[model samples]
Target: MTFPAFVDLLRQLYVNVAEHEFALPDKQQTDSRVSLLTGVHRKEVSRLRGAGAPVRVVPDSVSRTSAIVARWLADPQFVDARGTPLPLARTSEAGEPSFAGLVESVTRDLRPRAVLDDWLDRKLVEIDDEDRIVLMEGAMVPRGDGEVRLYYFARNLGDHAAASVENVLADAPPFLERAVHYDGLSEELARSLEAYSREIAVETLLRLNKYANQAIQNDPGGSSRWNWGVYILTSDATSLVAEETPENKNAGGETA
Candidate 1:
């Protein structure tokens, strides 16, 4: 972010905290109190206060598309024996696992053709030689637009930061936030390990996704919400290297 944008965000955050976390006995959120706590001027606080709380609403298109794709990827009828998504016909008149049925199973509000058209425009899906609709690889991962990608970026990073921060501040760590870091590995070995991790991560995600898909269908009116995500990063170590250990120095003593 540019320095000005960052400052604006920080200022807004401070104002929110002051109003919600440090309210007076009369329940008034005073600008003077916010200015004192956040080092923002009282006048700036008053100006921002008029904007109300920060908006956290997810776009309808993003939420609905994500749900539909999740079900497509996870629902047993939509996948083959090897768990790959099966190419679907346009409607149930063609057969089971038709694209129209797949969409209606999620929500009757959106027409299957509309979703298909959007997906085609976004390159999220393609038509096969037989005229079946086939999901494109990496379709689940957001791409092509800064707005969509940035939404996921903010959500995943924000949740991770929230968990890590809660763990540090709480007397007992209530969140799961753990990682293993090893240095001094040859680039080849590091890449191999990363591949293995990716393999395992995908398997875990698919398993949980299937379970969650069934769960939401069973409890469609449920009020609670949850999120699960995985990430990996690799970079050159700037600090002094330690001796590489092991009987089998390979990734977990195995390969991907």
Candidate 2:
């Protein structure tokens, strides 16, 4: 952020924090009270009061819908021997888990019908003639929804950066943060590798997700949030170049 913009943001933040933190239980939120608490000038506080609150874009944690879908894709009870998600009855039978079971496993506090309706509305799952629900997509990548796409963009990127930072700042054994890079590849080779890597990454993530869920269930300690992701970017060689002229010398200090 530019100097002026950052200063403005800090002022806004002070006002917001003061307004919330110093709020009187029996009385209204007063600018004078906020000014005294936050050390912001009363006039500035009054001016910023008309301004909006500080913007906060935190990573989205796993929702009930996402948890159910992850279990559907990972849990053995929800899949066949071939490792495919089975078309499941709404309710379980004879100790077997079903679609409703999946939802309940994630959250018993919520009504299973609400989850089912949400998935149906999002077109993430389908209903069969017997009222069984079938998985239409393997992953919970949102589609045809601009707002949801933006939400995922913030959530996924924020978590990814946080994980990387955590690994880097670790005192003991750090979590894994590894990547492979290659350049000067033929277009055909690049395409083939991209496809192969995608299949391997997807399968590995699904397998790990299954194991993680089981581990969470078995752990005696309370639960914590965890997430990992795989991504790939491929670009041609020309995108890296900068035009060289008399004003800017080439790599060897020779003008081009």
- Could you say which candidate leads in TM-score? 1
TM-score of each: 0.77, 0.62
Best by lDDT: 1
lDDT of 1 by residue, 141-239 (tens): 787855566567655655666577568878989877777666567888789979998889888888899888887776858566688888877776646
After superposition, the stretches of candidate 1 with alpha carbons farther than 4 Å from their true spots are: 1-55, 239-256
Q: List per-prediction Cα lDDT, in the order shown.
A: 0.77, 0.70
| Per-prediction CA RMSD (Å) | 5.4, 9.5
Candidate 2 segments exceeding 4 Å error:
1-62, 93-96, 128-131, 145-148, 163-175, 221-224, 242-256
Clashing residue pairs for model 1: none
In TM-score terms, candidate 1 sits at: 0.77
The whole-model C-alpha lDDT of candidate 1 against the native structure comes to 0.77
How many collisions per candidate?
A: 0, 0
Looking at model 1, which ten-residue stretch has the lowest summed lDDT? 247-256
